[model samples]
Target: MSTQTQTETIVLQPTPHTEANTNENESTQDQSPPEVKWMYPKILSAGLSFFVAGVNDGSLGSILPYVIRSYDISTDMVAVLYGTTFFGWLVAALTNSTMTQYLDLGPILCLGAAIQILAHVLRVWLPPFGLFAVTFFLASLGQAYNDTHANTFVASLHGAHRYLGFIHAMYMAGCLVGPFVATGVASANVDSKWYLFYVFPLGVGIANLALVGASFRDRMASALTSSRRRERRERNASGGALKEIKETLSISGVWLLSWMVEYLVNVRDGDVKQMGYVPAGFYGGAFLGRLLLAEPTHRFGERRMIFIYAVLCLGLQLIFWLVPNIITEAVAVSLLGLFMGPFFATGISVGTKIFPPELQSSAIAFVFVFGQIGGSVFPALTGIIATRVGVQVLQPMLVGLIGASGLSWLILPKDAELHRD
Candidate 1:
């Protein structure tokens, strides 16, 4: 049977036997405690997890100079840090679905939270440079798990597009906060006390764990168990993780979006290289764009509007490239960020619509892993190339990436019906 057909059967499967058994099932369900709804608290907690991830991701660039100073390392050496991050996401991509088969959602989330906490604990003490790099791997693994699951859960809810926007906005909010915090802590001591900034996320990580536990406690085990059983039954016909990974990777949308985000984040700041605060404007623009553009993008249609946004981003990149003034470059970069902000969430949203329901989690996880690849590989490549050529190459590189992203969107499979807002 086809994967979609098999999934439909699993979902529509009837209870064995007859009316009495059906009545008994209904009675049992009626007596059971009310199902945990996707209440505000649950949504908020999910958003917080993404927020934590954002802070971790955002702080790196801002504090990188401090790290370079403290470790006496060259800029190119920082590629190792991003390399470790890709490793973490790779591990998550390989293991996420398999882990879900054996563990409940709550436990999985807790595990991710614990991993992040451990990373922060290591960071707070100003460990060796090697250890610091290891911390990113640990943290990225945690983020991969937390973010993939949280995104899947949120995307399944009512008004999912809006909620996805809100959660991603929270992530941007964290990214926005990270720079200020890292810069502040770094400047205050100027003696390598910048590592102390990790203490902030350490506290936030604990709260993230607590909130995930509390909010998901009721349904985590049962829901995950049922999901696994269904997945197992389907696996025989559909193949397993390898098959799903192949399917996800085959999707052109995944690769294109990955390239877009990678270039957008890594290259946009190339013009004003030393000013750490400048990238924050990019993130801030992304934050606002996700918040403000969610509705318009949906109203106009994801595929169409995304292409429009990409064109706008390309225009901004050209201006940033040709413009001589740093102020103009910064403004262009921020506008580029604004245009690019909705791409990630929208891409995932489209994935959910395009992929089979049973494969959504694995598919989304795989897409995200590819994104991590882009995020890590392109930046490292940029760093290596910038050392030889000038950082000025970032502009034309961004233009190429943006153009490719638009073309990719143009060719992605069009849904017969748009997902309701």
Candidate 2:
């Protein structure tokens, strides 16, 4: 039995009252809390972790320019530092399923927060760029675990669609705040300003740590009982982690989705953030896009919305490429952010609803891991193109990649399949 949406009633099996059944059996079953009632807060609380993750990642990217200038590093080295975050995600994607088997959701979330806090402290104390990059990777690795686990946990909870949207939107909210807060701090002090970026996350991380402790007991009790049954079966299977991974990779739709995100990032590739006007424009648009359109877009139907967004995304990339003046580029990026803002959230909402609960976390991770792959590969490709062809060609290449992702939308399952029980 399943309750896919929050508005829906709890779905549970009724126990039979046979000749052998006794009064004690009825009392125990009667005492159990309704599934829907218990699941609501669990999903909501888990969503906050995604919020913290967005704040952590968004703030770092926003402050990257300060780090580069402060350390007197080459541009390529700076890119490598960003690249390490992707490397961390890649490593997490590879190992997460195995790790989840032994650990409870609450412990995992708390540990992730702790890791991120330590990484922040390390960045503040350590002088060298190498350590900075290493710490950033470590932080991302922690985030990766929390992100996947949170996605998994919420997918099992009540009202998957609304919960998924809120969770992802919270991440967007964090993204919206991170740059503004970091930039504010940085602008206040010209010298030694990079250290200022750590302030917001350090505070949020502390709050999140406390929340984890409050919810840990109830959430873990539910998670262990549900996940353990699956774990036992997996253990009984003769094939090990490598086999599980290979099996996961073999799914056609999963690979196709990964390709979709990889291409999307290719279209979005470059240092759009570090430049004064461009990052501001992109995220500013993203902030407005999410606020104004996320709910309506979801209401219209996630699949069709993605298709429309993809087309608009392609156009935005084209505008950035061919249009003259930094102002025009900024406008184009804003539009890009506006259209692309809901893409990941929409993908996750639709993907979770379509896949069975057992497969939900891995599937969400699969899609996000592709986004990470895109984050890593596309920027490097753009670097090569900019060096060889000219920076002017970057937008046109983005247009092309956007078109590729849009084309893949043709093969995605229809809206009916998306909402099916």
What is candidate 1's lDDT per residue for 302-367, written digit by digit as tens?
A: 888888998998898788667766678768868977888888877766765665655555455556
Screening candidate 1 with a backbone cut-off below 3 angstroms (N, C-alpha, C), the clashing residue pairs are: none
Q: Candidate 2 residues 277-323, lDDT tens each?
A: 24545655665665566677767776677678888877766666566
TM-score versus the correct structure, for each prediction: 0.81, 0.75
Lowest lDDT sum, 10 consecutive residues, model 2, at: 6-15
**Number of clashes in every candidate structure?**
0, 2
* Model 1 alpha-carbon miss at residue 183, Å: 1.3
Number of the predicted model whose TM-score against the real structure is largest: 1
Could you give the C-alpha RMSD of every candidate to the true structure, in order shown? 6.6, 8.7
List the candidate 1 regions with Cα displacement exceeding 4 Å. Answer: 1-38, 190-192, 220-227, 233-274, 419-421
